[model samples]
Target: MLLEIEKKIASFIEQVDSSFVQELFAKIQHGKMLRSKLMLAICPKHPDIITLCAIIEMIQIASLLHDDVIDEAHIRRGSPSINAVFGNKNAIMLGDIFYAQAFLKLTSFDRNIAQNVAECVVRLSRGEIHDVVMGNSFQESKERYFSMIEDKTASLIASSAKSAAILANLDSEKYYTYGLNLGIAFQIIDDLLDVFGDEKKLGKPAMSDYAEGKTTLPYLLLYQSLSQADKQKLKSYFRISSMEAKEWISEKMQEKEIFEKTQDMARFFANKALESIEGENNLKLEEIIKNMIYREF
Candidate 1:
């Protein structure tokens, strides 16, 4: 997949250098290559592999660059965020560079692929805007929080899988539908990590979402299930009036019901994602999808 993508990108973007554009493109290529390997594990004969890989790289980089700005994130991929090192102005511009690079690579392919990629990009931006606005109040509804993750986190993965099927000229509609479901499952497990997994395993702060006032699924379910006293205690943490609030909330999250409910929801989505791939020779990809449900990070 990467060999095909590098060959095509080289053919298209002839002038390469050690600038930020090159660095951004390189990161995109890395992510695209990983996703492509996951795809190839299922369908080795997939054609248009180069286009799929290129598009994935572009989309992933766009999100990362923008996400750093949105989250005011200091670290990404265990390194200082682009915004932190380069500042918001340049980081945003670099994100734009990546966005344009993705589209430039897309034009080398057919119109359908380009359009599909564009749609996913739009959805991701929309999701991010919604998340920014939700802020501290976002945790009010579990469904609303899940919807946000669907847009912000899972849309790119959905696009990656869908674009691959589309580029291969296979069942594009069903392939994307499967990808969408898989993306939701993948993200639910990611939310679980925010509460239950180690920061070292995830390469970031474990409870950053909570600290950021993002109401993830696990937090939402646990919040809803909390006793009135516990709810009051959790609210105090979100208020940030006292530094001791985190310990109080941590004690409440140890409830078995809270953990089990979130796990059940993750499993439900994992099953739905598997069901979406009926009749496709995608077992290896399916295994990758399922492992995400129980993955440590």
Candidate 2:
């Protein structure tokens, strides 16, 4: 089923008929297709599921390409980013092309589905801008952090699940709630990976988030648990280019058991997602939450 969706994605790009685009696309590292799984899990029997999944995948890729440029990141999924290899111009253009193609495909879906996905794109882009602004300062307000993640990450995931439910003729609101919580948990786990995950497995440098001036949940939560002097010390180390500073942060995080706190927070969101689908008895969705939140172990 995923293969069919991949083939559909290929056809969408192949329509561009540009060898350069094909070359760039070839280098993209596809993840687990989480959005595709969400849709298929909800509406496996829908005739248009393959096409819809392909559209969502394109949108996801486009967002990532733009994000890499914005973050000035050189690696993605352990491979050199397009902006790093082909230059930002080519990368941004390719991303634009994918976004354009995705929306074009989106028009054929039900109006509600189209609107659901389209509105997410607006919030996603806005969220990216918010991240850039927030990155300029040390983010301490949990309220602001949660709001940013909701727009930047969870919006698309939530919208995808709701749209899937719409197709399945199920209760869209319940699935949206499930997806929203699921997306929040997913992003928190992603942040955790940057701090504790092995660099070899992560495909990027561990602890790169702080270097970029983005204080993720781990740092924020840890700060809340620290002594006044330690909190100040952590802030002083922000964006410090020395390996020693990175090590100190790591040592402190371990000493404070900050990662455990982060994991519990992630599980909190995952449990909420599970609650939304309790009566539906969707084991696949249950497994997704468990695998995602607990994958670090």
Candidate 3:
């Protein structure tokens, strides 16, 4: 099933543009394709499931391309980012093309599906704007942080699940809730990885949030517990490179139990996701959600 989805994605890209653009698709083929998998799991019986999965993957890849540009990231998925190799302008154009293709593909499906996807993109753009603003000033409010991630990360996932439910004529609300909670948990775990994960395993620099001036949950939690002196010291570290800040944040997060607290919050959302899908009798889907939150990379 996964292979079929991949084939459809490749075929869709080939149909959309020239061979040069087709080559660009290779850079994005390395993702875990979790959104595609979730859509299939929710609506496996739908005849158009493969195309739907492909559309979801395209949307995710496009978003990642734009995000890497915004973050000024050079590496992604253990390789040079599209913006790194192709330049930011070309990368942004390619991302725009992919997004356009995704919407074009959605035209074959119901209008509601396209509407949902479009709405997700709007939320994603708003989230990115929020991230940019917060990244500059380093907002400390946990509620605001979650709200940003919900729009930036969870909205598209929720749309994927909802679209699948709509196709299958099933309970859209349950799956939407499941996807929302799971997406939130996924981002929280990503935040933890930014602070505590190995750079080699993460395939990018550690403490990237600090480097980007994006305040994550662990930082917010630790900030609340820090003394004035410690906070001042931490502020000093943020001005340095992520490599320099990594060790200091690592030690402090451990000392303050920030990692543990962050993991607890992730688990809380994971559990909420599971509860959202309770009585659905889809143990395989449940296991996928569990692994998503618990996996190292």
Candidate 4:
């Protein structure tokens, strides 16, 4: 199913004039396709499932492309990012192109789906703005950080699953909850990986969250237990680019068991996602959610 979706994506982009766009698509790994899989698990028989999955995938890709430009990130998925290779201007334009294509395809479906997708994009943009405003600032509250991530990451996932339920005339609210929890857990694990994951496997630098001055959950938890001097030391390291600073932070986080605490938080959300789907015989999705939170890289 995912292969066919990838083929359709490739065919659609092949019509575009830029060779860079083609190269970018060619390099994409389409990791897991978890969103599509979740949707299919709920409404496998829906005639438009394939198209809906394609739209979801395109939206995800478009968001990542724009995010890389915003972060000025050089690497993604173990390779040079599109913006790193073709420049930020082209990357941003390509992201817009993908968004256009996704909405155009979605027009064939119910108007509600299109509206939800548009609303999701708006929320995502707002979240990105919040992240930018909070950058390198340790003053961010944990509540605000979770809200930002829910809008930035989970909204699309929730909408995608709910859209699938809508198509099937099922309980959209239940699937929405499932997707929401799953997305939050997914993002939390991603934050953990940014701190402790293998750079080679992640295809990006580890401790990138710290380097970028983004106060993720691990740092936030660790900060509360630190002495005033240690807290200041940690804050000072945010400005320093040295590997030693990253290592020092990593060692401190380990000493304080911050990583384990972060994983516990992720597990809590993962369990919530599973509970949302209780009694639904979707064992495949259940297993996927478990593996996603527990994944090493």
For model 1, the stretches where C-alpha displacement exceeds 4 angstroms are: 2-20, 23-34, 38-43, 136-138, 239-243
Count clashes in each candidate, considering only residues at least 3 apart in sequence or on different chains. Answer: 0, 0, 0, 1
lDDT of 2 by residue, 136-237 (tens): 878889888989999999998999899999999999999999999999999999999999998899887888999898889999998898899988988888
In the range 150-248, model 3's lDDT, one tens digit per residue, is: 999999999999999999988989998999998999899999888888889888777877877888888888988899998877777653575557777
Residue-level lDDT tens digits of model 1 in 142-201: 777778778876677677777777656677766666667777776777777877777787
**Model 3 deviation from the true structure expressed as Cα RMSD, one decimal place:** 1.5
**TM-score to native of every candidate shown:** 0.87, 0.97, 0.95, 0.94
lDDT of 3 at 95: 89
Go through the candidates in order and give the C-alpha RMSD of each one to the true structure.
2.9, 1.0, 1.5, 1.7
For model 3, state the Cα shift of residue 74 in Å. Answer: 1.0
TM-score of 2: 0.97
Q: Which of the two candidates, 2 or 3, achieves a greater TM-score against the reference?
A: 2
Better of 2 and 3 by lDDT: 2
Model 4, 188-263: lDDT tens digits are 9999998888888878778887777688888888887788999998888774568888888888998999988999
Note the residue pairs that clash in candidate 3: none
Candidate 1 clashing pairs, residues 3+ apart or interchain: none
Scanning candidate 1 in windows of ten residues, the lowest lDDT window is: 25-34
- Please name the candidate that would achieve the greatest lDDT relative to the true structure: 2
Position 72, candidate 4: lDDT:
85
